[model samples]
Target: MLASPRPIPSQRLSRLWYLGRATGDLAAGLGFKGLIELAQSQAQDRPARIQISPEHARRFAERLSELRGAVMKLGQLMSMDGTDILTPEVAEVLAGLRERATPMPMSQLVEVLTREYGRDWDRRFKRFEFTPVAAASIGQVHRAETHDGHRLALKIQFPGVRASIDSDIANLGLIVRTLGLGPKGIDIRPFLDEARRQLHREADYEAEAKALERYRACLGDDPDLAVPQVHRDLTTPNILAMDLATGVPIDRLAGPEYRRAERDRAATLLMRLTLRELFEFGLVQTDPNFANYLYDRTSGRIVLLDFGAMVPIAPSLITCYRQLARAIIAGDRAGIQAAAIALGYVGAADPQDQVAAMLDLLELAAEPLRSPGVYDFGASDLFERVYRQGRALFHAGVFSAAPAPETMFLHRKFMGSFMLARRLRARVELAQLVPLCL
Candidate 1:
């Protein structure tokens, strides 16, 4: 993820204060009995129990949402990036925090616009739609039309979002600790911190404008893809202005109108882009949220959006994964094991235990590359079987803790994209594409 801009010392302290306030509530409720019950419930066949009440969960979600700074950012990460760590109830509750952000008032909106486009900015736009077309945690987007006849999408960050970031992060750490998410279990802190950094980078419209141009140039001459043009003169640190591209969400391939071959081709293009992004480009869009992709049915191309979360992969790590892929295809289990260990995936104690897990995980990903015809992602029991095996490991103390935060994000992005392809019933020549990297 792109590095976040540094904050002032006062801002950092404020963030810690907010974190303390949130955790203070949890500490008061979490008595020794609560802790014991949490342990007993966790020891059972299911996941760790939430000894806390539904009412408290709602309250917790609300505070995080209202804070809507780093705290909400971390909560949203758990919703998407750490879904496995949470039970269904907790996941559902936490996911709401992603969408529960209170909107910034129109007055705040005008203030932001004035700062970006100047006092005469209203005159440049023939019409400004104050009502947002969509809302996410960090900001809301509005459809606007300029006198120059360009329909643009304006992304306006919520008031104080930048200012509150540090405090929110500090508060998030305190809450996670108070709730007992540490190295012994799944350490979600890295994921949370990384997400916050991206969100902060995203808050900078100027950076996104630059990243958008870089992506467009990077993917130049590709007929099957599209990236929107940025209006640099009008862009600002918080307000991103770009041409409003028209296309349906990529998942539209789920429709019956999509031919199997077309579905497969679409999936192929996406997977190929992913491979190139990592192996060749050394740059990746770390956030693979479904909303980022759009389908142009008439042209048979995919429209890519949101460059703020674009990240650079280290050449060494990319080489490591590329080697691992070559080993997997060559059926070198020992090589794969060694790669896994080098990647901090396996500890010396019961090392094979983790290798077995990696094998099972890779099998799910590699199945399509080995098999022909439209892959039936719907029919696969990978999720259930993996869940069962994972639960067993947790019980036996054979399974180690979570993968590195970076790996976890990469897995989510891959799984998310793979699921999209599977939804399309895409028949990609994944195996054929692997050798291209080597």
Candidate 2:
């Protein structure tokens, strides 16, 4: 058995640790900046390929993975949106968090299982594996079997993760502010506060179990989808137990061996699910890590996993988004801006030029929907164009407010699905899906 992790730092102590790490990063960044300036002065006409040392980024990621709560979740969020804003080295390193996170040692796993069940917990299972099958920012999952021949997946929360949420959130805010990862004018406090709230919800396994049951109820009849059945007897606030569903990670289908038509069908199914989550169910699983989806080839079903990040949609916001979708389909920029203002994306007092720029960016994002037929995500330049324009707008100090909590997660879920569609080179007729949802 491996040694357990050193206990995560508490509220007061973690703040100091985060500060120290931030200071180190600041020094490294300044050093890199100075080197760039010196190189520019020496080579007046030549362009330079600028990158930070890989070690700086690696160390940063390692520290957050070790902490494993709000800090790691924040890293996951940054990695999701970091391509345009972060240096290549930093972005590459943070991207690792999206993969299976570091798992707890066998010893720590024993302690948690013992705490949740009794020290004689082995009696409850016919067989239980000490090694984890998957791990993430909040927990690690292991395989188990009951005496009645039921196989199960047990998601065990890290011992201290829930306790450390508030501190990790505060520490992350300090680190981001000190490093200035976003535009200077943007106030990310609302985002940070929302992250804190969501973290609390995610850390609660009991709540996640209820969400799983709710989703099963709503989506159970769908022939192309699968949701695991929760094992309530084995479940607790710190541990979630569900029937083990066999499947390959959805990303595996992105390879050349899969037929283009099959890939397109998969993407379309996911898009339809997103529409249902928004307009029909009003509930969404916001974390977009591709690993959360699995392809059960035998059944041709998309297996949904991990409901910890599920969130309910606001009804009013859905109406606003419906209007925005209609405006995008009609190519009405003014209508788009009006809907955006309704959704709190802009203000009445903003200058017309600034609002127009924002509307243009929104329209660009809607490129896939504007097409009357299939949208070729693989060949599209919309993502790149949007990044370039959004960055330019940010540099111009056009954006001030952080997105509302509902909008932020909704955007994450939708954008994440789009990125996956592109990865699979999946073509979809998104315009048709939009109306069905409305």
Candidate 3:
């Protein structure tokens, strides 16, 4: 069902413009580099010059959180990948910003509802919770039961989010570049362009509905998981209605009460899903926010939410990934490097020194996947090794930042889930799922 077009309001537009400008100003000031310098200065107090990164990163994150929107979305991404780049405190700030969406007041919500249900939306729902059940970058989700007695989750897009996307990305790119996070001196124009395209697609709920149906068909058979079903009729570009799969967040792995064995099972299911999404189905919901996965312990199912960032991979891309996976399983070092070079990850122009760094990273990444006993997330040394090599590569201008915009968001999602699994001390057999892809 097509949603009636909802026009943008003047007031919302002005608010977005104001937010965008504030973010741009901050980007120009304490950008990524500024954050690093601030952190570095704090490091001087220590004998080993150990960075007090978490504290400084938190300060910067506080600013990004206040700005919200696409910038907040970016902060969430940074927070998820904290193992490599950010200290825990800095990551906390980013993580704090993750689910912290600015609420769309009842007035704005009504304007959105009026467009979708023909001004009689309040009448359609027996009751609508004014307080949002979940809040994300461009939307806030509410809980409601329809007059027909169906329980549904309602996701309403924040007012004027679509219009400000371009400005948001442009401003965000400026901040990240000034922070020197990407390939130094590389033209990141392509990545920014891809981000804008994806964000616009995310603003559309119709596409998400279609994608959700397809995923249901794909993973509906997984006894250990649940993908929320889309309510097509109730759905608008802005409003996404679905049956809510209630559960404790996977992040509860961090709590003391969760059993060790239970945590391992949760981690296994998550790993299996990623392998299935990338290799078997060639379709994936790429965003890796910890908020996206929920643990319904009673049912032993992982609830997957959000499909706007989904990507369908080409056969060759899947082939490249599988080849890389195969190389790891076989423990073929030369084969791994060949595949990395073919995948355009290890550049031909990179001297032997840089090539060694790439090899070290590849070897570290393949470790837990290849080990016979268990992959230890708690003891994982890969993050530090990669972080060190990543910094060196950036300084050497050896690596050109590559966003398989397809795999880009997927990586974030996978990494975050894995971190959660690690915190739980989950011992999962990597080969079990990888073999399915094979």
Candidate 4:
């Protein structure tokens, strides 16, 4: 069933109003004791580490979700990256941002279509579904068929999403800072800047259409992968039209109905695709949300979706990664440290012990790559070990220096793949795949 339509707060003032209301709700939900704790923290002049109740978190998430733009997008990013820092209750609530978003009302949807395709836009289609098949931060996608009998998915942008990106990001940053909701002493400005840049690119459907075509070309004749073809006639800056690819969500492969072999194969293909995007195609779809992938069981292919978050990889960056990969595979500590320094994973001026700790964490992460044969993701506690080590480093002030934005985005994709593999309990042949990428 489609979510009940909610009009997006498109103007800066309107979005700010919703944010203020959400903040108000949070404060009220805290109760007297919580307010006292906040006052105490302020008196001491230390960072407020108030634990949000589940209900308060849910209310906050609902408000952001309703905005359906950069605010929601940033919330989704935080949900994924803030697991270590955010309380479990808050993280769990924010995770809902990844699911289907509340779609725009039909009247508003029609208005956008009319603006892009004229008042007689209905003449262009034999049938257009009023309900969205998928709703996301920037847009909602509807299944439609043209008079010529071509089936297409139309991604209609939320009105004013492009114009409101800057304000939405600024408002979100202010709220996070004021509430002391982010990590203490960490400079999140760089990440917020990256989010703003990415949001702008994503809001441009024209660019995404071009990115879709380019990515499809890069994957030409790949029997295991499928990318939808762009439908140029119906595409516009606010509307992206493409062939309607069919499949079940990729995460379904983790179910018992799927054979162990199938699970392994699916995960292996994804890992190989990630490597190819970095080392060969030089274009990576940086958003690793599982919804972006689908499994076509009938054809035994992985169908790719959503090209808005695609990023170009510099050759130099690829070279650094290749060096890092080879060093990890060979268990060469000196080579690994050198590559790490070059990649900005660790700074030259960082304390020796901190640098060594970072290197150890990197080595632990490369365990799968160094495995002689298939590495069983399900059997490994690698993620937990890495998380604990990372938390330790964070407390020791080792993560003060943020990696380059490109590196941060690329790692998000890598970690997404890793988490998915672990979820499916897949045994990937990283031993073979790592060499091919190098």
Quick one: best TM-score, which candidate? 4
Candidate 3 ranges with C-alpha deviation above 4 Å: 1-67, 81-90, 178-181, 347-357, 400-405
Best by lDDT: 4
Alpha-carbon runs more than 4 Å astray in model 1: 1-102, 181-192, 252-265, 347-366, 369-373, 394-405, 422-429
Prediction 4 TM-score vs. true: 0.88
Candidate 4 residue 365 C-alpha distance from true site, Å: 1.9
Model 2 earns a TM-score of: 0.88
- Consecutive 10-residue window with the lowest summed lDDT within model 2: 41-50
- Considering only N, C-alpha and C atoms within 3 Å, which residue pairs clash in candidate 1? 15-167, 19-171
Question: Which residue pairs collide, candidate 3?
Answer: 32-179, 33-179, 286-409, 286-410, 288-413
Compute the lDDT of residue 396 as modeled in candidate 4. 77
Which sections of candidate 4 miss by over 4 Å?
20-60, 78-96, 181-186
Give all candidates' CA lDDT scores: 0.68, 0.79, 0.70, 0.85
Alpha-carbon RMSD of each model? 6.1, 4.0, 5.3, 4.1
Per-residue lDDT tens digits of candidate 1, residues 135-207? Answer: 5556777899988899999878777777766556655666557766654556666777776676688777788
What is candidate 4's lDDT per residue for 141-206, written digit by digit as tens? 899999889999999999988999999988989888987877677688888898889888888889
Q: Which sequence of candidate numbers ranks them by lDDT, best first?
A: 4, 2, 3, 1
lDDT of 3 by residue, 121-155 (tens): 78878988888776677787889998898899998
Ranking by TM-score: 4, 2, 3, 1
> Model 2 misses residue 274 by how many Å?
0.9
